[model samples]
Target chain A: MKSTLLLGTRKGLVVYRHQNGQWAMQDVHFPGVPVSIAYADERNGVWWACLDHGHWGVKLHRSADRGANWEEVTAPAYPEGAEIKPGEPAHTRYLWAMQQGGRRHPDRLWVGTEPGGLFRSDDGGREFQLVESLWNHPSRENNWFGGGRDHAGIHSVVVDPRDENHVYVGVSCAGVFESVDAGKTWAVRNKGLRADFLPDPEAEVGHDPHLLVASPANPDVMWQQNHCGIFRSVDGGRLWTDISEKDGPASFGFAIAVADDDPDQAWVAPAVSDMHRLAIDRSLCVCRTDDGGKSWKTLRHGLPQGHSFDIVYRHALACSGDGLAFGTTTGNLFFSADRGERWQVINNYLPMVHSVLFVE
Target chain B: MPSVNFTYALKRFFPDLREIDLKAESLSDLLAQLEKKHPGLRAYVLDEQGRLRRHVNIFIDGELIADRDALTDPFRPDSEIYIMQALSGG
Candidate 1:
């Protein structure tokens, strides 16, 4: 079981450690700075902190021995001639996603950034180069737009555990893209996705996937909490199936987590529709699907029932073993021990949580 | 020689940051020299396109620079250059 929870909040990275059957606040890093992503690379025990500095721009930092020491690394940069459009020059506005390569490629790291650029670092994150193949895709110029931000961004990068060369990235307003040859070539995989905002609801591109996760036991089974609803892909990402609950609280949300051993089991934090963006009916609940979204069970025990305005971000919910944790926009953090059966408050006065990850 | 000073907020990242004097003719050239002295400082002041960051301000002798995109602003010898973060917050 992962015993440490890293909460990337607007103010800093708050860490909590579980010991003696109790979770306690362990340490805080980069206090007063907004940590967009707090990630721990389990392969090499290297921890990464992606900082969204208001005045200094985006920055990256890494720590080898946990949070005791950290070293700043060069953040990914768009090339000199790169442009978001004909006249708008492109720069890395935000670092949204970070993932390590397969075990075979130990030093390889992938970083997804705003302006829709995917960067790769071969030297363990000391330097990075833009993956131009995906950036120069034909659909990006006209089809890729922003969802919640001013420009398109890549927020999820899933590296195939079986083959390092195969990768998938989820882009806001651009849909899912698959690369079979180590990001040298790409193909659209939004066959069954629906974008209600577009003229064509089932367009090949322009789908908003809030978060994407693959089942550890069966990587072929992928799940995403999308703007439209919840979706599941049984055959990798070649095709998707809508799995959202019919006229239920699970219809809209941002975060999703799949069980490690069961592809049919997953969890999602439920909120109102996009317009409201609040807990359903002024009550907080987490919906669990044990049979691959065919049915859902609402878990609300130990949660606020009324007068709550908490909403979870895309990366704020995570699952490890039997442990489930999520942080809310209103600075409320909850943890569950028996899957989603019960929840306990971890913290209530932290800053707005951007991401939450369970690290070893 | 022109001496350049930085905002104290940057000291959080660059703890040893201090005033430095270098011989340069233009703001762009002076920034390149400053990058050599302190690595990664130029990125805080200028973006990937070499343009001054939107929220960063550079003043020559207490006057804000005129050119931000091309960085054609000039500075004289023995001039005092101040690089600061713009006032922005809720």
Candidate 2:
């Protein structure tokens, strides 16, 4: 299991290190800044922090030597003459998702942003260029709308470890899109997703997938915590099946994590539906499915029970080996060493954790 | 040459920030000159489309510039250009 946890919070990038059977606060970067995403590129041991400045727009920073020092790099920018709508110009409002290009391309980096744009960097994030193929797709203009944000945003990027050329991005209010030729061309893959908010629930490109993840051992098995419910795809997202609990708290949530070694095993943080974004029954719990979502077991050991309003964000929940961790909107961080059987509170005064990442 | 000033908030990112006088024609030209002096400073003040950032303001002699999109606001040779961040409540 990874020993370090990098937390992107509303206040700053908080890092905690587990040493000698105890976790301690190590360092804080970008003090008093809203770090939307805290990512560690395990391939090259580089740490990245995506900042969402309320007054100065979005920014990106990278640190090669752990957290000792950092260097500001050019954040992805929309090209000139680009527009979100006919009259509204397109600029990078937020950096929601980031992934390193697989082992084949050491210098490649991918970044997904709000207002619906994808960017690629060929030189290890020194500079980034917008991927025009997906941006200029036919359905982006009319079909893609906002879910949680005012404009559509890409929040998930899954790169097939088998082939770096095969890329997948999950967009809010736009469903899933796949690229076979390394982002040169794209196609929608929302065959079974249901967008209940749309006029047509089965629309091809307007589904909201809050977070998408594929099992590391079996790349073909993809799972998403969607706006409607939990969905699973057995054949690389070509088709999806709703596996949400019919009469349980596992029906609605934002974050989901699949075991790296088991495609059939996954966990989800359950909350009340869209109408009420609070902990189900005012109690916090994580639901686990070890048999491919056929059934779910709510794990409440060592978690808050009764009168709790904590709900995890889409990017806050993560799992590595036998360790699992998640941060809540109400500034609580919990970790479990034995899957989701039991959890321990790591902190209680964090500043609305945005993303929680485990790094070796 | 008009003297250019920046908000102290920017000093957090660009620690070397200081008052400087530069020779330029318009607000756009002045910004370009400022960019040369302080790398990556223009992006903090302007968006990708070269428009003034929504929360950032550039005032020429205590008055807000009228042309935010084109940045065509004019200033005298000895004018004091104040680049400030708007006080939107946190």
Which tens-of-lDDT digit does each residue in A1-360 have in candidate 2?
Answer: 899999999999999999997789999999999999999998999999999998888999999999899999999999999998899999999999999999899999999999899999999999999999999999999988888899999999999999999999999979999999999999999988888888899988999999999999999999999999999999999999999999898978999999988999999999998998999888999999999999999999999999789999999999999999999999999999999999899999999999999999
RMSD of 2: 0.9
Flag regions of model 1 displaced more than 4 Å.
none
Which TM-score value belongs to model 2? 0.99
The CAPRI category of model 2 is: high
lDDT of 1 by residue, A1-360 (tens): 699999899999899999998889999999999999999998999999999998999999999998999899999999997999998999999999999987988989999899899999888999999999999999999999998789999999999899988899999879999999989999999988899989999999999998888898998999999999999999999999999999678878989999998999999998998898989889999999999999999999999999899999999999999999999999999999999899999889989999999999
CA-based DockQ, model 1: 0.82
- Clash totals in order: 0, 0
Q: In angstroms, give how far residue A351 of model 2 lies from its true place.
A: 0.2
> Candidate 1 clashing pairs?
none
Task: Judge candidate 1 at residue A113 and give its lDDT.
Answer: 90
TM-score against native, each model = 0.98, 0.99
Estimate, for each residue in B16-59, the C-alpha lDDT of model 2 and write its tens digit.
99999888998888888878888998999999999999999999
> What does fnat come to for each candidate?
0.70, 0.73
Candidate 2 recovers a fraction of native contacts equal to: 0.73
